[model samples]
Target: VTQRLCNQIAGKLNSRPRKRLGFFTPQEYIHAHL
Candidate 1:
């Protein structure tokens, strides 16, 4: 159970950065388009 919880936390931590990066890229793209 502890291992599973740890893995879930790790997965969220990893994906959080990726999600932020994706949002940033789109915002940059819109700025460039404008």
Candidate 2:
């Protein structure tokens, strides 16, 4: 249950694009920075 919920949150954070990130998802933003 805890693991499942954490997976859901991680999925959203990795997949959702943000305006503050110039419309890039968290994963993309991290790669772009590095």
Candidate 3:
């Protein structure tokens, strides 16, 4: 895969809410912690 594709995938994954995080996206969780 190209670098651009990898970034797109990462962005999508990070923007998705996970049940383990109380339905918060990864980005939201990181910002809250930081």
Would you estimate the TM-scores of all the predictions? 0.45, 0.66, 0.79
**Model 2 lDDT per residue over 1-34, tens place:** 6999999988988799999999999889999999
**lDDT of the structure predicted as candidate 1:** 0.62
Model 3, which residues run further than 4 Å from truth? Answer: none
- Write model 1 residue lDDT over 1-34, tens digit each, in one string: 6999999987766544335456445545556678
For model 1, give the 10-residue run with minimal summed lDDT. Answer: 15-24
Q: Return whichever of 2 and 3 wins on lDDT.
A: 3
**In lDDT terms, how accurate is model 3?**
0.94
> So what's the TM-score on candidate 2?
0.66
Residue 30 lDDT in model 2? 96
Sum up the clashes in candidate 1.
0
